[model samples]
Target: MTAIYRSAAGAAAVRDRYDTLLDRWPVPSGRRTVRTRLGATFAVVSGPVDAPPVVALQGSGGTAAHWLPDIATLAGRLRVYAVDAPGEPGRTAEARPPLTSPAYAEWLDDVLDALELPRAAFLGTSLGGWWALDHALRRPARVTALALVNPAGIGRRRIAPLLKFAGYRLFGAWGRRRSLAMVAKGSPADPGRRAVGEFTFATFEHFKPRLEAIPVVPVERLRTLAMPTQAHFGAHDVLLDQRDAAAKLREAVPHADVRLAEDAGHFLPGWAGSVVTFLEGERS
Candidate 1:
């Protein structure tokens, strides 16, 4: 846990806060700590046991609990296994395998093997989307479908907004909030969005995010993706070039559905409905 947190005490506080969130999970669920090569991989399993399985991966600073906003809708149609990705602020191992290495694919394979799932669809956001895309490219047979939101690896990261964000961090709390506003698209008055923002703010207070650069997927490799695929990008995204992401995806995977939300940023709060629809469409 110290690998992801600043200190032992910080890890404990983050875990406690995360556990409290599980009790409030929108649907009936059970926690599963699958022993993987990386370490004990924690996942929250919800929805009908007989339903089609979907592996859900959170972003860089998120936990399985971060699925709180989307779980109910997704779980209603598909069995959702929301994982606390290793090295993130969750009850998973602190071992952050190198993003450039094949380790993440192997770790995900171990997760599916331990879960006894022969194959499953994937729902990944941000860095999680990178994991899903990488695995799909590496082991396409094991992945049934793919749904990515503001995924990394397909677009180049924009420099200007990032530099501005770094400059904003110099202002302290107010600066941090300003930084967050530039990332997630939501009104401060909306209770649901505000709640998620509050949780994210609190989590980062104790968690340390990854500093390593995310690798971009090669165009030739992306062209090999054969599964049903969809990607969402935010026009106002400060981190990655969303227009380039959408354009590249369209060029590489002609059949893939790519959307650019003009009002959204890096964090898309109300994206569950469209994602669920896309996932369900593949089944039908």
Candidate 2:
């Protein structure tokens, strides 16, 4: 099951929280642009030009801001381009059409083309991870490396009922607080909880469209991807059973490196030092 955030009031609260967080930990220095194509607008945040390039994609209903925590750690090592998914909210604003997996691949390709990046490492979480892997398969030459954190869509495992539970239809101030508490349960670190809450609430406000638009890539297709890939999944992921998902991923992308975080959940990237180490190791 997918949760879509779409109440006007709820959106505002989320926006406020995101803005506040950005204010506190501003991007060191970079360029921000609004790229438009196919009637969709994408907000692109680019860091140092000479650094190794990486494009970060967030999960379903999430925006580019979902990467802020990692961005702080990765920007210096790579020219990170975090894109506000066209269909989700944040800087991107457009009436998105119903998108299939292929359409999503094309959209990401367009974003890369617009940025004039010949090749880049792709990092994604949950739905974003699925998209990253799909993109790699669609244009193997364009991807240098791929990293997925507690990603979704690798198998048929069901998400835990608690993680799927949202107290309100749309998260307002109270909903945000409650949602944060739920997210905190999966995250081991305090900073991780704060970052997850901010990102989740923002997603709740801006993204619109049916959850089904995010396609589940079958195991057969995954086996064909040739990019250098590393996937991390929490042992206790509430959204998807890691053991089954990891096994399927291994069968499909036999060459891909997979890591299991024993104490984490679906929100593994927010775990600070651990994720930083993972990214650093993969980059090396």
Candidate 3:
């Protein structure tokens, strides 16, 4: 396990560098606003209003900034709205409710109402993917399409390997950095890797506390989803077993199309072109 510098100065430096990079390569031109609801102000990042809408939900401890890499690639064809999940960091006002699947679905509906987007395609990664799936099940008519990138909440309950658990406990910060590094290496888009990694890492840092409060999804509820779903998992993902996650999703959404990215990891959307092609082809 690598040691993370615990000093205030070190943390500050890390934060400053992260902010600088975010400012330089901001998510393609969009509107930013806070929607006050349930004692929280959820931050909303919206692209062109005239285009077909696609809402992006970032993973646990991840922010809207993580989707910037795929923004331009997706925005050309659709209006992209990246939402900062409440209770997590990065622009959203924090008033965290108990992190349950149903609660998340309700909150997402509120966000859509605030944005005035009656129906839109939903794209998500990891924990965000879990919420998106649950949201689709709860409001099938509101979601036109579903795209999940290495989504969580699909596997059975079991403790992670001892060594991996120990590493996460002892070197949580360093482990996050290493994971971001791996994401950068696995990403197919070269120019966006470093920028996206920095953004994702910073988001992880900011949302660490809130993330711990959320529980994994229950396996029994997986069968409820009925959307035209497209899920992608990295063959070599370190967090959740790719094969297990994919299998569970297949069992849940029997008709959904599932694909595997041979060399990718949890950060599947960094391989934007493939994802875009899959969405376009599947929709067509």
Candidate 4:
């Protein structure tokens, strides 16, 4: 089959950068490859063998390296399995499946089964969050707890100014960096984050990532998710109306714990600690 990357050289460069990122990880980890019918999924596993498991899903155009900050904290007390979401700009197979189907749920289940884990807490950000919810709605028995960080599809996603995206496509890295800065939380002063951002921009220049309009689950469906669930939103995420998302989640899923981080953006605040608390503690 033809490759999804714009060019083999571009894919090689991204992987080389990703290799360097693996060296700077906060904790020790091992890479595991899980083969599925759709594709071969890749994951970086860390932490204690006997600890409760937490499956992490990366945002769009994101790789496992993006979770470096969270891994140190979450892995201290729990096993962290960060997957390279297939079809995104990662090492996973470049097989893009329709988002509006049960494929993601099935794929996620396959991942869990491959890991020999029947149930585990889930942590997802942006597009990853949507996948977690999608799987929970389809197979609630597999997800022990859920955390959505600045997720999409909860409310109507706000479209960024077309001109902003246009500029990135037109002017290359400079414009791409500008667009990323608009929603990113902190400056890329950290070498790890800087490297990740570079790959994200290079992805934009090469591959055309599949864009899907994540549909909001019906309020009835939202209420049916009986597992312990929480959602974190950025107070000022330009990518979505977080205020609206918080309000709707409160109304539809009264049992949910929803929090808005002040002055935060779509990149999300360093709230891995909060997610750990939610997963480890009983829901009120």
What's every prediction's RMSD, in angstroms?
Answer: 2.1, 3.9, 5.0, 2.2
lDDT for position 158 in model 1: 73
Using all chains and alpha carbons, the TM-scores for the candidates as numbered come to 0.93, 0.81, 0.78, 0.93
Leading candidate by lDDT: 1
Superior candidate under lDDT, 3 versus 4: 4
Q: Rank the candidate models, highest lDDT first.
A: 1, 4, 2, 3
lDDT of 2 by residue, 221-262 (tens): 888878777888888766677778888888888888887777
Put down candidate 1 lDDT per residue, 65-106, tens digits, no spaces: 767877888999888999988888888888987899999899
Q: Evaluate model 1: give its TM-score.
A: 0.93
Pairs that clash in candidate 1: none
Kindly report which residue pairs in candidate 2 clash with one another: none
- What local lDDT does model 4 show for residue 182? 75
Off by over 4 Å in 2: 1-13, 44-47, 99-101, 157-178, 192-195, 202-209, 269-284
Clashes of each: 0, 0, 0, 0
Between candidates 1 and 2, the lDDT winner:
1
lDDT of each: 0.84, 0.66, 0.65, 0.80
> Candidate 4, residues 173-265: lDDT per residue as tens digits?
678777777767543346655666666766666665666667777778787888888899987787778888888888888888999887788
